[model samples]
Target: MSQDTQPAYRRILLKLSGEALLGEHHYGVDPAVLSQVAEEVCELSRRGVEVGIVIGGGNIFRGAGLAEGGVDRVTGDHMGMLATVINALALQDAIERAGRFCRVMSAIRINQVCEDYIRRRAVRHLEKGRVVVFAAGTGNPFFTTDSAASLRAIEINADLMIKATKVDGVYDADPFTQTDARRFDRLTYDDALERRLGVMDTTALVMCRDNELPIRVMNMFAKGDLQRLVMGESVGTLVEGSRQ
Candidate 1:
């Protein structure tokens, strides 16, 4: 393949907020959004980039919000985990429909619905050119899906981790509210933490920093952004160690 068409990374872990699947709706998964995301993923797979995904459950449930409303924190988190599984299944269907082999692997077991997450098996699936979607937030309470994305990316030995968001990249201020907000092209992990950039949770940022894993934050809704990013087109805010 020519340099322009070749993918930059061999394998990647994509972290998507559940709200990304909300589209124009106030709640629930939006079919249009799911289809669009699946098409993007399948396109990457077709280009020989191994893809793994970790999607959040905020659209269906928010554990932290419920805990503040008098529900038990642990119970709420478990419920939130289940919500992720629901999204994984939905996304898996969309990916398959887009003509790619997909798997839904959960941290928590649901034998009849999906495979229990196994590090070796998940890696093997990626090597075989299949997309794996990881659901459930570390199978533990109080851990965000961001943390799970970092953990899984490390475990799978991914070349990069991509955090998909509505915004094009990290900004000095809320881009939607601040018309003049400056979007950062690059940032160090320490810079992100020190400035409280909210690129990901502190734990997730620290994990990537300590492990030397790079993260690319980009707008998922933008046409061809994901494709351009994976093809080494530099379409997002890249966060890594101070070295680069």
Candidate 2:
């Protein structure tokens, strides 16, 4: 379908899981997952959707777990940051392989591998019609990538933030384990906060809510779900202040 035919946002931030990049593997990165993500992202670009991306490092390193085991928080955070950088490089290769121009910008200066993250430079790249992949988890410790996604969304003035998760949508309980869990077609930030929904981190949720930013949570594993989410169609769950 032509992009003009069905796109809800002129610009969006795609928050992808590192595990999604690993496909079905027990561990490590998977080429198939990378290719699949590239296909979907390229489809969005084809439909005229400007895309910015934030990648998670869970599949690579869950440093918080290490910190719990007695490692210094800063060291653990550095490991997580490096993991995100690896995901960023993989995403850059996949996006470019799909024939869409993309730039990988890291919070840390890895001049030989990718460009360093500079707000002005990132904006310029986007304005120039290039997809920008943001990595390295805010370049600090004790902060999750979810927060980074929110900060980048606001920094780049994104229309919406599409969180590509493992579930079809958000539920009152874990859908996988709970048989009676129901999915909401839409929700408000207040409700999410009041109920302590696990859909997003409290800090990230508060940032988006305060800014009146809309967030869509959808299953990346489901076929066409991510694309549909980007187009503002019924996909997974839509959490917002109101419908436009």
Candidate 3:
């Protein structure tokens, strides 16, 4: 492959918010959006990138949101974890239909539906060129999938962690509401944390910083964005332990 086509990283962990699955809908997964994400992932796999994914469950249920409504926090969080399993299964089917092998591994076991999450097995799946979708949010309450993504990325020894969002990159202010917001092309971990950029949850960001794992935030819905990013093109805001 030519320089432009060569992948920048051999392995990556992709974090996708559940809200991203709600394309043009009030709630629930949208088939079109799911297929689009699957196709993007398949493209990466074909290019020799070992892909691992951690998807959130905010679309179907949010533990934090329910806690404000008098729901027990632990119960709400467990429900949220199950919601992630639903998303994982949906994505797995889409990826298979897109012509790539996919596995859904849940932190909270549902034996008949998916494999239980085992770190070694997950890594082995990636080594064998299968896309592994990690679900169920660390199998615990009070922890967001963002934390799960960081944990899984570190466990898998991923070269990079990419957080796919609706916005193009991290900004000083909400880009949608503020036209004057400045989008950062790159940032240091300290800069992100100090400024409270909200790139990821504090736990997630700190974990990546301590481990020196680089993070890239970009828009999931942007055509060619994921491809460009993995291919070494500058397509999003990259956060690292220090300025590179």
Clash counts per candidate, in order, are: 0, 1, 0
In model 3, the Cα lDDT at residue 19 comes to 97
Model 2 scores a TM of 0.95
Q: For residues 92-120, what per-residue lDDT tens digits would candidate 2 score against the true structure?
A: 88889899999988887888998999998
Q: Over the stretch 72-165, how does candidate 1's per-residue lDDT look in tens digits?
A: 9999999999999999999999999999999999999898999999999999999999999999879999999999999999999999999999
Better of 1 and 2 by TM-score: 1
Query: Model 2, residue 164: displacement in angstroms?
Result: 0.4
Q: What value does the lDDT take at residue 145 in candidate 1?
A: 97
Model 3 lDDT at residue 180 = 100
Could you give me the TM-score of model 3 versus the true structure? 0.98
Q: Which pairs, if any, clash in model 1?
A: none
Error of 3 at 207 (Å): 0.3
